[model samples]
Target: MKKTTLLILLLFSLKSIGQQSKLKITIDERIETLYSVAFFNDYFLINNHENLYKNTLKNKLNILKNHKAVQLFDSLSTKYNFSYYRTVEWILQYSNFPEFNKTKNKADDYSTVSENKQFLLEEFKDELIKFNQDTLFQKYLKAVKPLNAKIISQVQNSTTIDELPSYLEEYYGKKLNSYNLILSPLLHAGGFNSEIINENGEKEVYALLGPNGEIDFVPYFDKDFIETDLILHEFGHSFVNPLMVKYENHVESLSSKYFTKELEKNGTNQGYSEWKYIFNELLLRATTIQITRQKFGNEKAEKLLNFEKSVGFELVENIVEILKEYELNRHKYVTFDEFYPILIERMK
Candidate 1:
């Protein structure tokens, strides 16, 4: 009886270890509110998809077109070079409306909020609450609830979503405490990710993805879009960006040597102006290619590699080759970070 009990307990432990966590896919009211304000303030005016807020919600929320929050955002955008993704990052630090306090720190101690902006947000807290209350944001959320439910249901059923955590954890040799996929109807074509170190010192990652369009009054995600762009690429940033910070000097030196004017121009056009940003993006894209190859197949991976190169990431193929070496020598390297310097040296 004792021997049989031990065997059953050991099998249960192995089964538990084998089970990977699925992504938590839902619409966040805080993100929706922030983007709604941004949309009315003309923040998404440039390079965003035509399908942004084109559904029934657009006309219903027009009363907030001139809200104080919108005015403040407009003025701030004019005064500073506040990129769309930067704005999203700033908003992610704050708690949900009515309080709007900065409750979350950026993961890995990278501060995205300027001290001046921080102070301004603290001062503007009441007005933000007023904006939320007066504009009937809860009512807007209620209207969006069913659409949110539909998208969540669709995403929960995705095989790619189910497979992502295991693939990423195995690749990085690090486990995230949680994964969240937040759907934003107002975000359009842009996808953003936030890595937050929670109060418990656990890493929580969020993939903020936009809707492609509404189908029969419900927001829809293109299967290919979710699998490749939103899932692999965006979440890959969480793993890659923090690791690159330690090698910033090496990246800058490499950029000086190889990041040509044309490459800088291409990178700047895609919102990656700095050497570190471009380097981090190259690493992330390369890793995404490698993960795709492992998860899907070589043909799909080759197609993605070609697409990335066409879009100005010319060095991605080389990075992918380096990543291949890392994969084969996991006994020597252990983690991708351990093999990063080899990548830096080979890039030269």
Candidate 2:
């Protein structure tokens, strides 16, 4: 690793908040504003000025050090919405966007499906209470509820129109028609995936909306996927998003040393990292396939991996560019070692 990267490693390695690492620093100005402190134990948001808040954080950090709460807390983050982060995020956005605060303290971290949107909101308050008791689902409270309309009205809390186009125009024989098929992205900040909905001239899309606040795309999931796994594969990014956020600075500065041949042998192949962009994207897709299989099941995992190979390296690299441009990329287990097989496996 480079000297600059090494500095980051040494900083976060400490258990105590010793020198306060800049591991979370990045060039993405928008993202920096969304920062929050995560209690390593419960993997929940620890950002707030309330006394109860600091008390909760201290208690959790103590448990984290003892390794006693790891299982329950880990389960909350790993399987569910991992809302801790998003909650912290939403609140920061919330304080700035007054509309979201209208929901009172009774609101819990639960979801409810309904025919009438207004009735759903009313029923949700009741469900949120039950959700918090689960220890498992409570983590998603921040992400579970919808954004206050007033909050969403602000440009900061919303996304671009094309960022997630609900319709696509595909060539089908001799005519052109509107297809509900689409891509739904729901990673940390959303816009994380693509899908082809099987809506027979209708709209049918869905969002992951994991129990933890870490995964909630309901806002954008106004349609359904033609095939379930196709969207899930993309939603898989939610699980992978935290891991990547764990390395936020790494990618922000990836370009700094990304394509440099500085570490290569005197004169040989493509340098320290060969195949560069192709290799990078191949790994991203591989990680997505692997993690989704592990979490949801292998049902369509293998097939998706096969699809990558068929897509060929060039096309895959182009796709990667799109992902990178949209700031939607991640690795499976949040480590460099795990990133290799994922990168190479996608090579056709």
Candidate 3:
């Protein structure tokens, strides 16, 4: 009887571990609150304070802004072309804190901020250490920790994280359980962002869930909202970015022709180099629209398309016909490799 019980318990434990949700959600109140302190301080420094979180954060942001640690960060930012907030991000990623510890790879160098191939944090390691030790940042973090429960509830209601993978699977007509998702609910003040990083020889997506201004203070749950759109948009990057890199030569050859001066000038707003940026932007946008249309009906998809156009992706609507053709004739093109080249040829 004892042997049977042990075997049963072991099997149950294995089952539980195996059945764990591919979508892992965490409300990293400390990291988000820390970033909020920096972001709000930066915002106030540039413009008159008009944020919704001003009343909750003004004093904290002010204190952080005046701290010697932040001053050192500012000086370093000038030298490095990366902001103090970015340094804080790197600190949280590298710190003893569990929330951020697994978000970066052990192999990648953190000397420079990865995005945009920007400045070196290695040069200012001492300054970064000093900034992380600042009493003000710690105090502000403690003061705001109590509000995390409420903030987490608000963010959960505003976005649909739990059902996202299932939605993506149903839309794309494939199994996506291999891809692990890290849903980090950031403070309402911080903006939304997402990135894919390789950690422990596995690809993990760290996505920031921020304020949904569309339904501000009106508590309701709907995955079809723009919150889903934002997630799909970022997730689309995880799909398209790697493929672009995999087919770098093919992408480069086509990019020069497709990326006209008009597209370059229009797409440079995000600081990405013109042709490469435009190509990625269009690929991600089209992927977003295709999957969104599958999950939601035509009306919602049309709204998403127009929204992309209004944001300066004026050529996206024309791609829909080609994507439709791809879907109808999918058997001919088994992979994106087969489909993408043909699609680009049609673009010509």
Candidate 4:
């Protein structure tokens, strides 16, 4: 019995180490911004996001539209919208565009970049040529090739890439030990999105970085708060969105009858395609506030809550109160999967 128990402990130790090893952070300016630009081409001027493009980023979008690459990417002769998005996703996931990946030799630090500008441009064109023989695409690549430097420079100037990973591990990483973290921070990538994937028995949380459509990253630099809140909020989705999938029926059963037209309209304004997004936002809002309170005390946490409220999360405080109860006696509810049903029932 003693020998068997010792073997089990050894196996558990190895599993812990293996889980920790899966967290990775990649900052690639070229491919990341390329993905962003391609995404802009796909969605720019479309009804869902048309107002956004016209109001805040009209000038940038106009200039980008004239770029050879944007023209070619936007002019794709595809039957379905999925094909266009799929093509860009394929490039981002597989192309491995080296121009952005190349970085100057340094002490192997997080901030190092390959500084050969001319070499970077040449490689950019060469890679595009390999990907497609279209002359228009090649022109697009050249026109926006210079933008990569601008994007990378902005990222380098804004914050240390190292700080992102360190904070993730320090604040909520261990608490979220059930899943692996995959972070990709990109420049000029408009808007943020996250998803959780379960492979076999392991779950991985993936978060993508995009341009701040609301505020410029530099002037609004409350690095400790802004960046931390963004990570917590996105990572919060990993925790809550999965529980949503598990309790889909329970969620749908929450009579949509109670949702006022204004509420439905508000949901649409919040960019939610369905009621699930509202639920996810509520949970994330509460989780972020709770975590902020844990780290910075109630005063700072209250300030953050107000900030969120001013930005349209008026329901946040009420939602936090509901989550606080579950948190206070957490052992009774080990995972969010266990706690959510009660919260939903109460909301109904």
* Per-model CA lDDT versus the true structure: 0.74, 0.31, 0.54, 0.49
For model 1, give the RMSD to the true fold. Answer: 3.4
What TM-score would every model get versus the actual structure? 0.87, 0.23, 0.72, 0.57
Which candidate achieves the best lDDT against the true structure?
1
Candidate 4: tens digits of C-alpha lDDT, residues 247-325: 8777777637434565556667666646666767766877777777776578867887887677566667777888787
Clashing pairs in 1: none
Give candidate 2 regions above 4 Å deviation: 1-147, 155-187, 190-204, 207-348
* Model 2: how far residue 123 lies from native, Å: 23
Model 3: worst 10 consecutive residues (lDDT sum):
43-52
Writing each residue's lDDT as its tens digit, candidate 1 over 1-348 gives 999999999999999877755677778777777667777777753224444244444677777777787777676666654555666666666788677777776665544446667655554455566767764666877766776777788877766777787888898877777788888877766588877766676777888888666666556787766776567888888777767778888878897777888888888977888888988988888888888888888887888889888888888888898888899999999888788889889888
Candidates 2 and 3 compared: the better one by lDDT is 3
Q: What TM-score does prediction 1 earn?
A: 0.87
Which regions of candidate 3 deviate over 4 angstroms? 1-20, 33-37, 40-54, 75-79, 83-93, 98-136, 157-160, 169-199, 214-226, 255-257, 330-338
Residues 118-174, candidate 3, lDDT per residue (tens digit)? 333443444334444567645655664544455546445633465566665544444
Off by over 4 Å in 4: 1-23, 39-69, 75-92, 98-191, 195-204, 211-222, 255-258
